[model samples]
Target chain A: MATALNKPDRTLDQRGLLCPLPVINTNKAIQELKPGQILEVLATDPGSKPDFDAWSKSRGHKILSVSQEQGPPKVFRFFIQRSG
Target chain B: MVLATEQLQEAAKQGFKKKLVIVVSKGTIDMLYPAFVLATTAPAMGIEVDLYFTFWGLRVLTKKGVKSAKIGAVGNPGIPMPNLMGVLPGMTAMTTKMMKKRIEKYWPSVPDMIKMIKESGGRIHACSPTMGFMGVDEKDLIPEVDDIVGASTFLGWASDPEAITLFI
Candidate 1:
């Protein structure tokens, strides 16, 4: 439950991208990480949270955690673990 | 009686099938977008994708068409632009340019979406009969086209029992 303990192998900054870009980029980024490695994605797209949730379910990937960073520009962060 | 885990696994494996086929028949900016969006997303979920472009849909693969793809503003009331302005010369062109710029703010450009689809492993097919009807040659098509095939060939790809076909 506490994914904060696990350091991400890589981080993807997807701010300013919108609708489907975040999902598309996140999918590609996960490919570079080894299976079981963590990928932290920071996206400003409002759709990113639901999109990642659906993607993780369909791909069998694990979503370790999802958190929000309220900013002058708000950001949605997802911690995902690549599935084999 | 509870079945063995191995038996359950075998049954689950037998039920698994993951293939998607989309047939696009219109080339307008609005019409082409659903196909583009879906094609790019499906492959990311490990589903194999085949997109068949036919008739006017083939225009989406052309340089001029893709560069100037426009919304049909006259008859349709969906666009907020005044119907009187729709008939004016250059109005459609002006509206399309403005719309395209606005779209870029929220979505990837059409060319980038096509590139993403290819890089994600989705197949793009242009209808061969349409090419002949329009007098367009292979050289006229963009580099992303995987093949030019007739209806029969596309039917063959869509006929697989495991494939889910959608007409867009």
Candidate 2:
């Protein structure tokens, strides 16, 4: 399915979490990935769109793509490529 | 005119100061969230943050108050007229409960936010005069409070040219 399309180096399931939690958890998760490694983040917070955009810009990470997955509870998927 | 030019030259040499100072004067649940939200966000953005809690806002520094902070729906402009049922005796508590449930969906609770601020190295200060007026001792405040200080001391920090100051 979604996993087969993009093979992420790390995937973080942040579903059911809120704003800063998703952002905070994403920060911790991304730190483990090496430079140029792809980190996939699954979050439910509506604020994640702006939060991820700002996070990517501030930390110089490249956002490969952001897609809203259709689910009973819609989820936001962020593909982030860590950049030094 | 010459002084302005020299100050600009010094600023260019030293880099712009990135600091935020916010004074929280109200302790209502609705009132306190903005301060916590901005305080935490600034640190996330690599900006130094200082929070000054005074008057009614001083309650937020207290363990009991922080744990049970209530929203005042009667006078709060954010909540509409139908919600003004808050003027009733038990309404504030009801409103607080409802707000907590809703806020949990998208944001951390007040106490959690405060903890996050402390963990992120944001400075929290209790107003000395207000503490004295309320007869609250240092032991009553949360462990996160860095200091109990007077207005002058906090004003000195906020007065920095590079500091963005807000009164919430």
Candidate 3:
């Protein structure tokens, strides 16, 4: 069920992967989506938020939102829209 | 005139793409990991990346050398062992195995990182002088190498005004 402003066309789970892998994989994953589609990323790396922020800016993509899930492992969630 | 100047500045900012040029000169597992990490990550960020592997770092471009890379325990202040103990037989191997085990749990291997770098359109350049000095022919290099280049060529690539050059 996709919601307005919160729906993602694709989701990438990067748990257990460290710095650079998450960013690298996210770059790869975003390439598969059509322009303006959103990608949901679920990552366990504490560094993902800033990495995604910088990545989205440099690539001209937009990060719709970033939130954290407070689990024992602490997951970071990012909804990013592909640039045209 | 002010409006025209602002437009020019805006255009320049939008048109400039970031570039990263790294010179990797050590072959130790400890040394190579950081180099490969940056090499792979830069391309993912839409930054052009060029890695110039020279001296011992040329080993990483070789099939056998990449697989047999070891962490040097001798004279390494970071390792807990004293210099005398570090020089003991089998110490380097033991240290290498321990380090490899830890690294494998959290990161991709050197060869895998190289593959990812290539897949992301990063350039891997082998130093021609090192290849000749070490008696390593083109056949010894892994398939990912883009070219064998001299210092002048690598320096030319690094000379881009916006390129961030690093020695690792």
Candidate 4:
């Protein structure tokens, strides 16, 4: 689905954060958003990938996409849809 | 029998819930098993799991220590020994080593579990406090650790209301 329609209602800046931090912060951000709101997560931690996937599945939230910036300070960009 | 659209929607609504976690610290040897076993399995079950090694808990995550881990015995109050075995006097460090060797034969090693945690997308961290306390350089910690962090940093993750925090 084109989650591009919505400007992310929330932004989770998890740069330099690891593992559970990204997941935890993402969860908290989603809690603060309204139904159908979007959350954008920016992280440098490699562990975010699995944590994000697991979180999305268990929560029934939609993951729009994960875009990686390949370089020093590599970035993982998560565009997410908060559903039921 | 074909279900109605409403029934299908209801079934979808009843789907499994999301599992969210902030931190898991295995503070002792006996405490190590449950935390990592769940960590490796929880993601497959759709839970977001992270293992944060701190204090002596880091013992489980470090590769070198696993081979030489001492099992507590003979009135060793600190080690988590079974009640019956606690009174046994001959179980010294050497005996601990032997016991560890026998147990390792039956199960996945720390390295194996750490790999699973990483491949399955879980995260691992070594506590900075413990590292400093033990005068352990970052190089001494398990290679699986993504980084070294203090308690405040760890707390940031657990601050989320939806996150479950555990001290193993």
Q: Which candidate wins on lDDT?
A: 3
Q: Model 2 off-target regions past 4 Å?
A: A1-5, A70-74, B1-17, B77-84
Q: List the residue pairs that clash in candidate 2.
A: none
Cα error, candidate 1, residue B119 (Å):
1.7
True contacts kept of each: 0.47, 0.16, 0.56, 0.03
- Which ranges in model 3 have alpha carbons more than 4 Å from their true place? B1-13
**Whose TM-score is greatest here?**
3
Candidate 1: residue A11 lDDT (0-100): 92
Per-residue alpha-carbon lDDT of model 3 for B72-132, expressed as tens digits? 9887898877878987899999999999999989888888888888888899999999999
- Kindly list the per-residue Cα lDDT of model 2 for residues B14-102, writing each as its tens digit: 77646789999998877888888778766555568899999999998898888888877787767654655767788777777888888
Which predicted model would earn the best DockQ? 3
* Runs in model 4 lying further than 4 Å from the true structure: A1-84, B1-28, B75-90, B93-106
The candidate 4 chain B region of ten consecutive residues with least summed lDDT is B1-10
What are the candidates' individual DockQ scores? 0.41, 0.16, 0.44, 0.03
Q: Of models 1 and 2, which has the larger TM-score?
A: 1
Per-residue lDDT tens digits for candidate 4, residues A1-84, read 564634787788988764554675677678788878889999987767766776676566888888899968899889988886
Q: Which ten residues in a row have the lowest lDDT in candidate 1 chain A?
A: A1-10
Cα deviation of B162, candidate 1, in Å: 2.8
Model 3: lDDT of residue A45: 86
* Model 2 residue B131 CA deviation in Å: 1.5
Q: Is candidate 2 or candidate 3 better by DockQ?
A: 3
List, residue by residue over A1-84, the lDDT tens digit for candidate 3. Answer: 238356688899998889988998899899999998989999998878877876776677888888889986899988888989
